[model samples]
Target: MKFLLVEDNLDLANAVTSRMLMDGHVVDHAEKIEDAKLFSDTGEYDLILLDIMLPDGDGRSFLEHHRAKKRDTPVIVLTARSQVSDRISLLDLGADDYMTKPFDHAELQARVRAVLRRNHGSSQPVISVGDVSFDPVAGQMRVKGTPVKLRNRELRLFELLINAPNQIFSKQKLCDRLFTFDEDVSENAIEVYIGRLRKHLEPSSVTITTHRGLGYKLDPR
Candidate 1:
């Protein structure tokens, strides 16, 4: 899954990004409200972790504007405010969930999953493509009831393909979702990752097929 993190504190942002990276999720970080808006405008994010106090302005206004535009992307507010009224106001402003600062990474991740599950209306988050089953929250895959070990990059590629089994994903689109803002991705990065993911899915009935001029899709054979 791809996430947009609106945070200004370098240390905190790095810690959170690192933790989520370990779970095989792509995270994009923005330090200011303007940059946050730019990221939101250009791409579709699975979820956004927004800090209440940004360098440019209050994120509440951003949330208000985002909701006003009918953008239903789930937002989890990160704030230092602990007052009940503050929490209530944030919720009223269209935050899906709010987490006070100085938070435990585990709890924060749990809340993120819970919010995503609620947003997608799934109680048990499991996605399937043929005999391959993936738990999005845990970032784990199982083939025929047996767990398969995958490198993070391979797992990320498979996750994208499995989530939209029949839909074609262009190389550019995959690169956008797979790499972050600062990474130096080679021209053949997407192709290489796709090749790696195909080998991992060999034991399962699912196969990723190229669409010639279009791109690629996961085909269940």
Candidate 2:
């Protein structure tokens, strides 16, 4: 999953980002409210990990602003304030979940997955496209019940396509979704990954089709 982390604490932010990367998630970060708003405005993240105390503004206000604009991306508030009232207020103001400071990295990761799963309408752990199945949490794919070995880039492209099947996504959109802010890669890289994915899923029951003027989509025909 791709996440946007909004925290002004540089040390904490780096630690969290590193752990998330180790766990195979793409993470982008913004240290202030304005930077966070800029990233949120783009509407790219599957979830937002927000800190209540930012440099320019409070996180709750940011949440209220985004909620008013109808941004439904799941948000998990990370704050030093661990009081019951604070938690209640955060949830009441439209935050999806809450985690306190100095948290267990594993618990935070689990919370991220839980929020994403609840938002995406995924009943089963595995998402199926034709005979192929993908596990979003584990980043695993199976073809006809046989495990398929996919390169990291190919897996990321397939994950994005399968998660939102039938939704046509342009190459640029795919790049933003699959890579983190710090990772520098070319737009042509998406095409290369897609081409490799087609070869990997070859002779399979599923198909990834290109829409002439639009982009590419996964069709389970």
Candidate 3:
């Protein structure tokens, strides 16, 4: 999943960003409310981890504006406020969940999965594409009940494809989703990853098809 992490503390932001990346999710970090708004304007994130106390403005205002625009993207607010009223207020502001500061990384990850599952209306963690099954939360893939050995890049590519099967992903979109803001990716990096993933899925009923001048889509063979 792609996420926008709106945090002002460099230490907390880096820690969360590292853990999310390790979990095979693309993340963009913003230190101020203005920066967060800029990233949110792109409409590329599946989720947003918002810190209530931001440099430019409080997160509640952002959430209020976002919901007013009818954006359904799920938001998990991170704040130090432990009052019940505060939590309720955040929810009323359209936050899907709330996590207090000094929270565990594992707990945060689990909450992220829960929120995403609810958004996608999935009762289980595994998303299946024909005989190919992918667990985004577990960062694992299996073909016909057998585990498939894949490199990190290959797994990331497959995850994106399986999550939105049949949707065409352009080369530029793939590159932007796979690489972080600081990482330097080659022009053909996405092509190489797609080539590898295709071979890995060859034995399964799932197929990745190129759309000539367009892009690629995954479908059941």
Q: Which candidate should be chosen as best, given lDDT against the real structure?
A: 1
TM-score of each: 0.94, 0.91, 0.91
Tens-digit per-residue lDDT, 1-221, candidate 1? 88999999999999999988877788999999889888888887889999999889999878887789799999999999999999999999889999998899999989988998898778778998778899877778898879998888778788888888879998888888888877888748888888888887888898889998788899987
Angstrom error at residue 153, model 3: 3.1
Clashing pairs in 2: none
Name the top TM-score candidate: 1
Instruction: Write candidate 3's Cα lDDT for 9-125 as tens digits.
Output: 999999999988787788999898888877787647888999999878888888887788789999999999999999999998899999999899999999998898888777667
What lDDT is reached at residue 34 by model 3? 81
Summed backbone clashes in each candidate are: 0, 0, 0
Model 3 TM-score is 0.91
Question: Could you give me the TM-score of model 2 versus the true structure?
Answer: 0.91
Judged by lDDT against the true structure, how good is candidate 2?
0.86
Name the weakest run of 10 consecutive residues (lDDT summed) in model 3.
Answer: 178-187
Residue-by-residue lDDT tens digits, candidate 2, 133-213: 998777788988888988766777888999789799998899888887677899888878888888778868988898977
Ordered from best to worst TM-score, the candidate numbers read: 1, 3, 2
Total backbone collisions, model 3: 0
